[model samples]
Target: MTRFAPFLLLALVACGDNDPRYLISAPAETGTAGQVALRVATLEVRQVSLPAYAAEDEILREDETGALKPVQGALWADTPPRAMTQLLADRIAARSRAQVAAEPWPLSTPAQALVDVRVSELAARLDGQMHLTGQFAISSPDQIVRERIAPFAIAVPLAGDTPAEIARATGRALEQLAEQVIATLRR
Candidate 1:
């Protein structure tokens, strides 16, 4: 009976339809005391490119040339990853001890720093590869401050057959990506 009780709780939690709030929410972070003039280099999310043939069948597939073809799922502007960027920006606002701002404006001259990210790959495979990678770059007006390769992924079971399941999987993958991006900014 004790074991069954725990299982019941697990089943109930698993049945939840509520998408995680953090996945889409990016409320502004509280500010710290500082006057450092820091501006978030308008992150240009290079429209995560992918081969056109990817849409014909499953997204996660390989080519005859033996290269692992990347996948391009929905580029929903309001997706978790985009929101995660806002979350990171919020965190940077606090952590950087510099006034942080995010938007589409390009710097007229040169900002004090920049954060550039290249989305190399993102998607869940039929075999559960769930690969995502990006290169991070931080630059001062004069020189690059940091550069690194960050990736996030996981291979869970193929048990749940549903779009929501895949969305959840992608969300989980992006969460890892969020962590990586945060780490890059910290360094």
Candidate 2:
């Protein structure tokens, strides 16, 4: 019984916190119809730069006091930077005629235009809205098109306070950003 007691204790110690972790993913569908014509034939989307809090694995919300707090047991399914860059690239390619890939661009030929996005704020606020504000720059490597930097502010109403709702709103906000980028590329 003494030998069995040690094993039982080990088992008990191994049984760590049993909290159910929810993995959140931002959906890429923008719900907008029709393909946009792009001046660039191919575009490269660099890894998205997220704020320290937004880059964390935990899903965060901005409290009434303007503090960012993580939602318990909720986490991003993929690395935030990579996931967001890929999402933007996919969304842009889907909505436009240009071929898009997230950097490091995997094509033999160089991309005509490169897009870099730096997100300053990405959080669900106490006002029941998910806010995404950032600046995106489009640079032409071969000098094919005009280079430009654009600031974007997007907010989507949260359906509920749950982490899932925040994730959905985040997706919506990103979709709007993608649309804006597409519009800029058309010029």
Per-residue CA lDDT of candidate 2, range 1-187, in tens? 8979989998998996564444334554565478888999999999999988888888888877888888887777777888789888988998998999999989899999999999998989999899999899999988998999999989899999787888778877888888999999894
lDDT of 1 by residue, 1-187 (tens): 8979989999999986543221322333354653233234333222222333322233233345556453344223344434545544555555454444444434565455555545555544555445555455555555444444444333444334344454455455544544454455552
Worst 10 contiguous positions by lDDT, candidate 2: 19-28
Candidate 1 has what TM-score? 0.44
Candidate 1 deviant stretches above 4 angstroms: 1-103, 106-111, 142-144, 147-161
Model 1 gets an lDDT of: 0.45
Q: What are the root-mean-square deviations of the candidates from the true structure over C-alphas?
A: 13.5, 3.7
Return the top candidate by TM-score: 2
lDDT of each: 0.45, 0.86
> Largest lDDT belongs to which candidate?
2
lDDT for residue 100 in candidate 1, whole number 0-100 = 44
Error (Å) of candidate 2 at residue 160 is 1.0
